[model samples]
Target: MKIDEAVEIVKPHLTKSRFEHTLRVADTAVELTDVFGGSREKIELAAVFHDYAKCKPAEEMKQFILECDELPNNLLDYHHELWHGPVASVLIDREYGIIDDEIKSAIYCHTTGKEKMSRMDRIIFVADYIEPGRSFPGIDEVRKAARYDLQLASWMALRNTIQFLVSKNATVYPDTFYAYNELTRQINGGY
Candidate 1:
């Protein structure tokens, strides 16, 4: 799908800030794609749709997870903040005929990244985390690492996420741990 078409499709569903964040993510994805060499078209589309379900009602998102065989039901057990990415992944395919697995997977894991993430996945993941609008402690370091090493940047984001959740006594999703461990190995040459 064209970027404009994708933007229009997602625009109405997002709040003004969220919509701007999505645009920033798309631009960031494009920049990262330039550095890392991936399909710009696929990454952009994935970035556009990454937050498509962010504002959906919890009941609606739960139903999507419950009814869709592709989405794991265990998602409902996690914090609702984590549901949007997986829900958006399935919703885009069902609602818009976006059946490209690369785009779908990138959207699916944009929240709590999975193990063995594709280059497209890392791009969208890092793009979303380091988008210019997002300001947080240690973000500058992640953004700096992103300029040169995608894996290291990804690991930094994952580490920061894990540490944040631990500090808050929040439940860290298993896939997040998987992503962190995999990237740790990759960076340390253990993979």
Candidate 2:
């Protein structure tokens, strides 16, 4: 799908601020593609719809998890904040016929990132986290690292996420741990 069509499809589904964030993510994803070398089209589409399900009702998201065979049941045990990406992945395919595996996977795991992420997945994941509007304690470091190394940038983002969740005493999703471990191994021999 063209970027403009994808944007139009998602705009009405998102609040104004979120819509703007999506645009920024697409921009960041394209920039990452330029630097890191991936399919710019796939990266843009995935980033444009990464947050497609962000504002979904919690119960509705739960239902999607319950009914979709592709989604794991364990997702219900975690915070709903992590549901949007997986839910959006399924919905975009069902609702809009976006059946590209790369796009779906990127959207599916954009939030909690899975182990062995594809280059496009890493781009979208890092793009979503370090998009310009996102202001947090360690985001600048991730953004700066993103300009050079995608994997290193992803590791930093995952580390910051895990640290933030730990500090808040929030439940960290298992996939988040798995992704962090995989990246750690790739970057630092799992030290």
Candidate 3:
């Protein structure tokens, strides 16, 4: 879908603040797409709709997660915030006319990430975290890493996420750990 169509489709589903953040993420994703090489169309759509399910009712998200066979059951056990990725992906794929597997997977793993993410997936993941709406410690470094090396940026972002979660005594999903390990290997082993 075109950016304008995607925006019109997603804007009503999000609050004003959330829509603005989505726009920023879309812009950032497009930039990363240029730097890292991915479909700008896919990046913009995935980034704009990435958080479509973020503000939905928890009971609704839980029901969708249960009915959706593609999503792992463990997603229901993670922090509720993590549900948006998979939920949005499923909903968009099923109803929003977005049939691309890469876009769906990018949205699916945007929060926790995954072991092997495609270029669009990596772009969405990092763009979401380092977007202008986000302001966390070490984000600057991750942004720089994103510019230089997306895999290194993924490792850095995962490390920062793990540390943040650990500090809060929150659960760190296994996929995130796997992503960190895989990215580490890729970066260190010169993959």
- Residues 1-191 of candidate 2 have per-residue lDDT tens digits of 89899999999999999999999999999999999998999899999999999988999999989989999999999999999999999999999999999999999899998899999999999999999999989999999999999999999999999999999999999999999999998888756
Please tell me which predicted candidate would have the highest lDDT against the true structure. 1
TM-score of 2: 0.98
lDDT of each: 0.95, 0.94, 0.90
Q: Candidates 2 and 3: which is better by lDDT? A: 2
lDDT of 3 by residue, 21-58 (tens): 99999999999988888778878889988998888988
TM-scores for the candidates:
0.98, 0.98, 0.96
- Candidate 2 wrong stretches, greater than 4 Å: none
lDDT tens per residue, model 1, 8-112:
999999999999999999999999999999999999999999999999999988888899899888998889999999999888988999999999999999989
Query: Stretches of candidate 3 above 4 Å error?
Result: none
Q: Where's the lowest-lDDT run of ten residues in candidate 1? A: 182-191
